[model samples]
Target: MTKQIEESYQLAKQRYAEIGVDTEQVLADLEKVKLSIHSWQGDDIHGFLFPNQELTGGIGVSGNYPGVATTPDQLSNDLSKALSLIPGKHKVQLHAIYAVTDQPKDLDQLEPSDFKYWVDWAKKEGVGLDMNGTFFSHPMLKDGFTLASPDKEVRDFWIEHGKRSRAIANYFGEELGQQSVNNFWIPDGYKDNPIDKLTPRLRLIDSLDEIIKQPYAEKNTIEAFEGKLFGTGVESYTVGSHEFYANYALTREKLWTIDAGHFHPTEDVSDKFSAFTPFGKGLMLHVSRPVRWDSDHVVILDDALIRMMRSLVRDDLLGQTNIGLDFFDATINRIAAWVIGTRATQKALLMGMLAPIKHLKEVEINHDLTERLMLTEELKSYPFGAVWDEFCVRNNVPVGTEWLKEVQTYEKDVLLKR
Candidate 1:
């Protein structure tokens, strides 16, 4: 650790101590939090399934960055580089389409054997793996629906895919000794107003019931359902809207995934955390930055991000919430994007942990509204950066912007060559 960083941390430690917050314990707790890094960020959601498959199902990558990962090995290597620069133990979230195999297999035919390479790599890196059933960007989804399709044949194909994905996720959990979150999100909606939204929703419910009915150890695989507000073509209505999934998850006692970018631009996901925690079995968060519509921008240390983390901390939902990144930007260095987004998430968590949440809550309970508001505003100016720098140092990662140099060096020597 640098002399200046240590000095700053010591001072911040004393300041937090005065507010009944243990800085050392907070740092220790921060290390325990694992943020799942998304694999799609390295390759702009382009999976190595078949040659020249167009991005379908409301999926879009906005830039033509020169060095996007073109193969499974390259994507894994890029993720490794990003993980090296970030602090804390983390997991890598993968889609069904990222499976590496000698022979081409359709989504319905995918098996755990196809992702043996990923399990081996995660074991070597000492990280966990999460899985997702890719319901988008396939020939079956060209009509802009899956699992909720009116066509019986189309719905059956996606149902089989979801079943296999859960089985693969179960394998991941048993092999890695960590619970694998198998998230289900399908871009099923109408470009214009639909004649009958109720019919599609009923079909979706039936499809999910079948998928979840497949016998797998509940301890190994966690089934999570994600909902969306709107997407590129699905502007008028989204079948799996928040209201639909919230009710479904609560009734079925399943994990509900709340993506930050999946709601209206003005809606606060943090506010929903408390509401959902009371009824749902558990929660999974897809942390992303949304501009206007559901534009997945790289997350930064913004106010919304801070508030979200603070909500988790305040509601004591951090343990129940499975945190994961869900943004992919192809305009800049992909590795850099991963580092920046992951670090920003960690930084936000640190800020929340360092806050005098107990005291703030006590004040609120006592009906001291003015003091609560004052203390909240005052805590914002605390030396959070000092604690964050110390965290990076303790994790043996570069402090401040020092990590940028490493990313730049990597781009020059590694990414630019591609």
Candidate 2:
């Protein structure tokens, strides 16, 4: 090989090693699968989480587990136990704590008793939490989090939870190395009336504002606004539509999240989904498999949006986003559910790695490229799902045949060691 190619190959190996990529072992393992095609070579490619730092890795945890611990102590103990089994490459994803269905008179105020379950849960689990309160089971906010609550008490209650959540995260982060939290599914737009005033929207703004005003808000903590489409007749904050929110009365330094499943989709436009690019800033990513027009959060690489997300991540417009499978599989038990969620994250990591490696292998290349240039004009123009599937097949990774079994083995043999 030429000197330039030899140097590039060595650089790739170094980059892979720095990012904790098991270059020699992975190539060997892929060969053992005995596929006809060769695995891609490691080269002088750069590993990225943001502009400069290389990410060690991340892992994911479920939000909808059954019979989870409720108290702080129980939560702390159980979460630690549960997370001990997962690989450290993924960040913990939470559904956040649910509010009491029928809150008693004295239970009106928000307290640690309700949130301690999650605080201890996160502390012991060694993972961050995804605050998914805007759309869960809160009787008071039946309509939605900030958009639906007509009662002052209800609005106050939501804000209180936001504060409590941040406080717990801040407290835990000082003790731990990382502090992570993201506000997802804010769904604060109108349903029936599209012409509503900015009052309800301001309430949603205040929810995020509460976190920013906190003493530790700016520390290691991230508040990602997850937008979504409301019901059939309802209109809400559409994905890729944050310019209006930025101009709102109570704007702050909040960032946007790209939930793979939440993007607006049609049979025709599914391949061309919008991306989140905040003039090159830290990002929170939501990864899932899309089934049809709606968000099934399926396990298979049914959509190419996953690839689209990886390119943005490679470009340094996003960083350190929590990834979790939001789909509800009625057939699987709780343990099985976690396994499924874990696999989705594993797949996402593999996909993210491919973007830069492919970029580095170009015959003629440019490193100083924008997202539009790198993602569209430079990289393969086809959907990423196809590429991911092709790579798995070529490497004999085995698809659609209970991939979770191999994941379980790897977790036991590799991850649980440390």
Highest-scoring model, TM-score: 1
Model 2 agreement with the true structure over 1-418: per-residue lDDT tens digits: 2344345445655655553444445433222211000000000011110112221111112243233333334323333433333334234444334322224322234343444454554565444544443333345444444433556676666666666656544544554456455454544444455554555565555555664576664455656565544332235432213444323311455655545555555522222223333332334454555555343443543335445445544543324333344543323333334444544444544455434444443422654456435544533432333433433444344444345575455445533342
Model 1 misses residue 159 by how many Å?
Answer: 0.6
lDDT of 1 by residue, 1-418 (tens): 5999999999999998988889999999999999999999999887877636888888888998778889877888999889999998899999998999889899999989999999999999999999999998888984788999999999999999999999999999999999999999999999999889899999999999999887777778888889998888999989998888888888878889999999888988899999889888989999999988778899999999999998999889998999999998999989999999999999999888887887888899999999999988888899989999998999999998888899888888888888
- List per-prediction Cα lDDT, in the order shown: 0.91, 0.42
lDDT of 1: 0.91
Lowest lDDT block of 10, candidate 1? 46-55
